[model samples]
Target: MSSLLGSKEATNRSFRSIADLTVLGLLTLLLAALPLGASGYVLYVVNLLMVYVVLSLGMHLAIGETGQFTLSHTAFFGIGIYTAGLVNNHWHFPFPVSILASAAVAALVGWVIGVLALRMRDIYLALATFAFGEAMQWVLLNWESVTRGANGLRFRAATLGELQLVSDLLAYPFVVAIAALMMALTFAITRSRLGLAFRAVRESDMAAVAMGINARAIKVTSFVLSAAFAGVAGGMYTLFTSFIHPESLGFETTVMVLTMVVVGGLGSVRGAVAGAIIVGLISELLRQAPSYQEIIYGVILMLFMMFLPKGLASLVNGRVALKKGCAS
Candidate 1:
């Protein structure tokens, strides 16, 4: 009887593995086709979506996987932007160097926050993170010599490798490629051992600790990983906009990212990407509309939260379950 049960479990795991691989393949094909078939504006939105996709993934690593309700992601995001900006603007470093440096700095900040907040419980941790985010914005706003204060700093057009992309159409593919690679990396991490540990920590930290898992190390690791991803997203945002500002690192922006994760799905990585697309497109579309835009956004978010608490990802799961039921 035990052997039979083990066999069944193994079979279920195999099925899940297949399902995940199929999804990955489909996403790859879709990404490959978009730049070839889509319009320039569509491609531009896709590029923007790719960046948020990374940012949302980072948020998912904390909120969804490790159950850390952090409001300090925007600060980490700023770390990346300012890191790249300072290096490129002053030191004349290469793009890769700036991005790497930004990621490292953001990870350091995450580590510091994690260490200091180790003893804090839920809301306390959230408040502390929120304060850290606000402080980061203040620093950026007041640091005129480096950040240029409220005016922000614009960069000259950048190149990837030897290719100087003068058009958005040209640059769009480059950004998309990097974002896609990062997304794959994130997906891998979500399916690996560390991901299971993250989920365990999220579900019950005390239980996880009792099970011999070092909860503190898991929390800190997830935090640092999330911060690194946020840094990458921020660097991309800066490059795409050709400028960096304190507002990008503010509480409002942090809320925006949080909205993306929550509205998409709590623990669904793919859902986070989907949520970004929905919010990003809706926000851009409503930019020209009347005052109703903000109202519409709030309404949609409320409706989704009420009706689809698990998020749109739940719909996918439901469909898959239905298909399996039919097969069985």
Candidate 2:
């Protein structure tokens, strides 16, 4: 009777934990949706927020989950956008096909980079990746035969096979859907056995290797997957913006994406999402201010690093802890 009672109690605790997490997730959804209640510039900012969320999620998968520090996710994003643009603009292929091709190409490059750099320590890996990103930018800028050199490419209307969708307002829902689906997929991965392997590797690659886990393979897989997700977001970005440029892969853009992940929280998915939204909003808001935005941006980043080092999601988790304490 005692064992049975203990089992039942354990089950109940598990259910309660799941319920709490579900409620928190629903609340996050509600928060994301709040901008929809506004219009014009607000909606535009919300769209930008979604883009950053996707970018940060990819970084979270690589850095937080797999323990790989990449300083050049933006390069993969640029590859995806440019690949999709080339396919769509030159070949006149369907949008879905173009997006997939972009992801595949980016994944291939990511795999190659991972294979080459996995043997190096973190700092060396970072420098190598950064170099590759700079090289990509130079190639995109000077490869006139393909990328049109300094003058970027302009894409025509995007299509879904026989169907064609137009208007930014109409397309907003699709972008949101893609972002949501990608985020959910990321969450699922984080909850699976692969995620466990990733965590083990992150905690200690040597230990993970001792435990019979292929650390190099895990790192490479994570990098490829992260690049693929970033590619999806990039494809969507290019289609929405209808243009592609070499500057998209430059060092500054890379720093911005890295900042989103670091500021949010290294390993937490929620932190990645929160960081992306907050940083994206601040950047867009600063753009509007123009005069004092740079000063404000630098100050905000410093404050985040100094105080809320874990990002806004940490603040949310703290409130949850406080509420549970009160309930108890």
Candidate 3:
């Protein structure tokens, strides 16, 4: 009996390993083929999807993993874009430098918000963050000298010494690479001690505190990390696009990201990425039917919540588990 159990466990692991490799191989093939045959518009949409992936991952880190409800991600994203764009426009710094600066600024602001937010919980925290997001949008719209107000700010093409990325096709590689790096980083975080602490806090702050985890510190760290992710995503935006507008970085944007995270499966790294891609594509498609977009989007979200509250990731995992059970 013992030998049989051991054999089964080994077989399960082997199957899982094979499945993981297969998925990775398919993803690599698809990404490679896309640039070769995809249209410019398709590349643009894919680049935007990459940015959404990073943004949703950040949202996942804060709300899903750390159990902190924050609605200010769009604010951090806008900050990154404007800050990095301004620096790049004036100083002509390389993409790396500007991206880092954007992340740093967003992280710093996030730290301040996190420290203050420690005083609030649940709905209060959500409301506070929402208010902050709105306030930031106002600042972006009214601050003519800095954000160029309603006129919007245009970015000169991003460059690396001699090579300038003036088009989405030229920027696609870098954008995809950055998104992949963030996804890997997020996976690493989820496997580390910090990730364990985040889960603990999410499960129950009191219980986590009893385990000697500094709940406040962990929460703050999650906020900072999430904000940095959003900032980097914003930097990625500047790489592919030429314009930044306050209207695009507002409450609706936050809601879109929140829906992606929730529909993808809250607290799941894979879910976040999947949700971003799926929803991003849907949103792009909805552009053709602007009159029915909101209604359709809302209905889809409602259906998911009603039937798959655990999100799409749960459905995939359920299928995998059923297959393993059959094998056993």
Candidate 2 structure quality by residue, lDDT tens digits, 1-328: 8787677667656865898689768956874675567665565566667778888898899888988888768888888888888888888887778888888999999899889977786899899888888988898899999988889877776777775645455456666777788888998999998999999999999999999999989999999998998788777775456777786567766667777886788788978887788778777756766566545656766887799877776776687666555644
**Number of clashes recorded per candidate:** 0, 0, 0
Question: In candidate 3, what are the lDDT values of residues 220-242, reduced to their tens digit?
Answer: 99999999999999999999999
Best model number under lDDT: 3
Query: What is the alpha-carbon lDDT for the whole of candidate 3?
Result: 0.92
Instruction: Measure candidate 1: CA RMSD.
Output: 2.9
CA displacement after TM-score superposition, residue 102 of candidate 2 (Å): 1.3
Clashing pairs in 2: none
How high is the lDDT of residue 324 in model 1? 60
Off by over 4 Å in 1: 1-30, 36-40, 289-298, 325-328
Q: Is candidate 1 or candidate 3 better by lDDT?
A: 3
Arranged by TM-score with the best first, the candidates are 3, 1, 2
Model 3 quality (TM-score): 0.95
Evaluated against the true structure, the overall lDDT of model 1 is: 0.80
